[model samples]
Target: MLFDTLKVSIVLVTAVTRWKGLETRFLLWKSLPSSIDRLQHFASSRMCASVKRCDLKVESPGFWDALGNLEDGGLDVVKKFFELLTSFPNLATLSLTALTLDPLKLQRVSEIHTLQTLIIHDCRLPRTFNKLSIRDLEVSGNPTEMFPASKEDYGLASFFDLNQVERLQVSKPTWGDPLGLFCTQSNSPISFSNMKVLSMPWTLSLSPTFPSLLTQCPVLEELRLFSQAPKTPSHSKFNQSGATTLHPSVAPHLKIFIGPDVCASTFTSRSLRTLVMASSEGRPHDIRKDVLPILTDIAFPGDLERLAFGVDCLSDPLLDYIAGSFKSLKNLSIFISMVDGERYSSDIHCRKMWISRLSSRLPSTLIRFDISTRFAGLNHSEDVSGEDLNVLMTPLSQRCKKLTAFTMSYQSAARGRTWAWRRSERTGYGSGQWVNTDEGVRQ
Candidate 1:
């Protein structure tokens, strides 16, 4: 079996180079022509030029039907495997699955230059594969008609040059109009100006040119957007007849924002500090008419620490506007359900009166609290005792006296049971359990 998996990968790379003196830089070869001559003798060994990192999965079809009987059909064995990965020179990082290169042999594997991180799945690239200068890039498949059939066609606009990409992820399952691949058509403007991090794909969050494609990522810290509904009443009537506008030169150094809850008030980051919304099987008056008027017309920034939502948009006037607006908040995550209808009601004193009205409106500079729920009328004729989880963790440990950490999880809805609890304010003590589906934590 591939020489006993290369003799247990040379005895786990000589016991991890004799316990971490370091040598094996990481490599995974799943179906590369059954060890293509032992990976061309470890790519001309010298310990394969100190392999930096590599993952290759060519999904064997008898190695492309033996290169369909040769005749350059195998593109010279994929250009001798990118000329043996440009002789490693501290190989940066590469992952390719279901490979299909030849964007002129990926410009000779993008002139190596210590290739910085590239991940591709269901591949096909070659319109000079955007002259790589990779600084982290991810591309997922199903790229509709590989875009650009006009606007003087340069679709994927030479993969947007923000001085050689800082971080970009492009997923396609028909990303229809990613603002025409980030603008062009005599409306010239393209800038990712040292893009920090961006993850987008729910077909570009139902594009109405998705808030003008976050004004071309100007100093974006982190942003993730994924969607599977909401926003289509003609793009919520062109964002309430204003024909779109989030311009504070969008994402101006935005600090962490995750998508969907209908694009949470189309964003206006005052250097936003971590906000995640996600949750939509649509209709709760279309998420309180498109995310409660952009969360009552955005103005969040008391150095907002972290906040996550979804308890059907936690309304009580959005938890009294997030406990009277984030007083330098400190990590809070929530996703509730308890399930019993008329809009949630598995009553345990109505989920401890919504966690004692969100622990008397949060902020005493709280510290780490995560809550997840499901219970949906529990099941097996209801059960959750231990005083219904101490009536939900004694009003969140007596309204957060600088809580060090607290987590609660439930999930019963019959035949999918789970229960968890944890507490640790410097181990003042707390723990609970009942999770197992083929054995997973049960104490």
Candidate 2:
């Protein structure tokens, strides 16, 4: 019965691809021995010539035991598997999950010169493999299991030795002294000369050596710090004085930063063009005081083009401060959280008035504006009316002449809606559209 099912499946796939004149460009498989035979047969067939990306995930212990049953303790079986994989001339991206990498087998796979991106998750790497020519590499593992809490792990170092790696993401490493692995203290630190983007997990950002490590990536253009949500509702506190100060000598070309609020005074990067202040999910609202000082202290560049704020930080006073601070700002996104109550409703009305006056209050150079609101429907209230929409759109159209794109969106537990307004240079004020369920307006 299993043999008949396999034959039918193969025949169906063959018929569909042949009939449509299509070639498989991507493939993902989750099981070993069972899928392995099919994968081998497919790769050897003429239809696989177009395959350029492949993902293989092996998490079952039985699969490894199956390999053990093969001759030469499964090493030859692994080698032959990779030998077939590298035969695909066009394969450029490969991802593996929970599969132990054999150095000898990887050496054979590394012969594929066209490979550009390699991603490995929760896998063990051999101490050394043939240097890959890939330009992008991502490695993720549990830090506690991957690296010893006290000593530097050379197992981690082997992957960084590839000079061709231009982008790197290290996530979920155990917090104890992992930054030391990137420091130059040993063997004149590894220089990622071609690295243009680097993303580190949040726990690593709190390390004292973080600033020093940034200094090493002279050409790094973008930095992203991914923070985990706290277990409690209380927000994390950052001392204004304890922020890391970046010297001009390091990462001089850095232009984009996305992470937690840092004391603006601590940053000296004149080339900064974009700043994103990340917010934790499920955090308490109205923590404006915690973020206000950071915004006020940051010496934002005159040419800063984009700025984003967390949901609870866009108070009236902060908006005024931003309007005055970033004269060259072109894109702005603000998130507001509104709850149902008399006081909250009044606050929303005041914010609506403030938003209507953005044409006069915001930077003249602005080209795009995005405002999103999360409405908590705790009390009975009227649905947003057409008149309210007109009040918000008219001033923006008349006053903000350079504005080209505008978006306003609202989300509630019951329903969600979005409005997009665009102005063309030729038609001027008369060109705009409102989109809603069963309702559409053109002006």
Candidate 3:
């Protein structure tokens, strides 16, 4: 799957091609307005040894400059680019960014039966959901960004049969504000009957577009909500509910959920294994209120193999809950940040117990454990000594016999040290610590 920047995605594209990720990553870094035509031309070229790659470069001084008047002929380029797909009979994946597609053009490309995965960002699509038969789709940008004003197009209601898509990831709106999922709600034909995995921004959960969208994908195994759950006017009331509760009867077969607190306690899923309940995007989580009381309240707690969350400060109860809830954990990552210049559990003994208790609870099946703690509130770096960090990591690394890697960092010390597991005569204790010396082959 493509690692889309606008989407809360990385793990979703694991089933697709390696080239597919690169194709999508390229778009995430920059718009490919000029690359469209050049990509089409490169496939037909045989004499690359004598050809000048510079000719395929963008003719426009900048991509933005090409947007209006000829858009550096971007529209014309994408029109011709569509024809290139019909040439690759076995082609199954296509990732494009920053382009536009009219209704007829979208229909023409949809006819490619071999296509099964489509990853696109910042592109204009047909007003209605046309018959695009892709199984895995990662999309952003508003549907109305560049759509034509045709009466035949009825927005997302006709984007194709939603049941055909098994995996879906959505990030930013195509353009401006989102198209609101669909223009007309009751008459919409969208369905997620076969959806197995879905990743979207947290803010969308509060928007009107999300309410109807969530109920449709009941078979989803993983649901990831990335980025900050912004306090937008649409769903401001749900802010206080962050990391608090899970909806009952939601995705009975769900194995992963990484995002903010959705409403209700109908969580009947017995297969959930990964739960990351916090605001990501590197934002500070407040210690004013207990950020994790919601952890104990999850309907079917425990049995999670991977867990992650944000915290204002470490506490005995919080660490204790983790040890009791998840016993067979393999991968764990924690995001710790300061809130308003102070640690919540500031007592020296409390901090030391947090380290010791946490160090003992790490399971042996664990391969990777990452803790990113930043003492942002302290006035001096010395306030958080390196010795304390060592006390925490050394035991964690040594005790977890199967650990493959671990990292612990403090904001004061910008360059966090990393320890990786190796097989042979590596520079480390009998176990693993990534000895940086120029010793035998480094692992």
Q: TM-score, each model?
A: 0.29, 0.68, 0.68
- Candidate 3, backbone clash total: 14
The digit string of per-residue lDDT tens for model 2 on 1-443 reads: 11101110110011223336756542222223465566666566564567777665543344333222332354333444566777676778777655566676567557767778887766655345545566887877654433334443454445445456678877655544545444313444556778888877655666676776676676788887665533111122222344455454667677777666552224434457877665543442353564566556556547688876555424455667778887888888766665644354323343445555566667667788777666566222544544666677677666566888886666666665667777767867634345683232110
Per-candidate Cα lDDT values, in order, are 0.56, 0.57, 0.53
Q: Which ten residues in a row have the lowest lDDT in candidate 3?
A: 4-13
- Locate the minimum summed-lDDT window of 10 residues in model 1: 4-13
Cα deviation of 211, candidate 2, in Å: 2.3
Per-residue error (Å), model 2, residue 371: 2.4
In lDDT terms, which candidate is top? Answer: 2
- Residue 288 of model 2, lDDT score: 54
Candidate 2 residues lying further than 4 Å off, grouped into runs, are 1-49, 59-81, 130-133, 144-153, 180-188, 229-249, 263-265, 279-302, 311-328, 337-349, 364-367, 374-378, 382-387, 397-443
lDDT of 1: 0.56
* lDDT tens digits by residue: candidate 3, 1-443: 32211111111111323674563321212334555545555444332222221111122333333233233444444455565555545556666555445566576568666767787665555455446766888777555553445555355436656678898887775322223443333444467889898877665665544545667787888877665433311112224332423456567787777666443223424566776665433455543353555565565655778766666566655665666676677887765656333443443223334656677766656767766555544345344344565566667667776666665444433333333333233645433454332331111
Listed per candidate, the RMSD to the true structure in angstroms reads 18.6, 10.0, 11.0
Q: Clash pairs of candidate 1?
A: 103-126, 265-294
| lDDT, candidate 1, 1-443, per-residue tens | 11111111111111223345646553222233544566567666555666776665454333232222221454343456666777666778777755556565576667778878787765544343564667888776544333324445444446435556788777654546665654345266666667789886655655567566666666778877654333311111111222333545577677777765455454644557877766532222333565456555657658778877655324566556666777888887766543554453233235445655666666667677766555446556554464666565567666665666655554564554445556665666556555564332111
Error of 3 at 245 (Å): 9.2
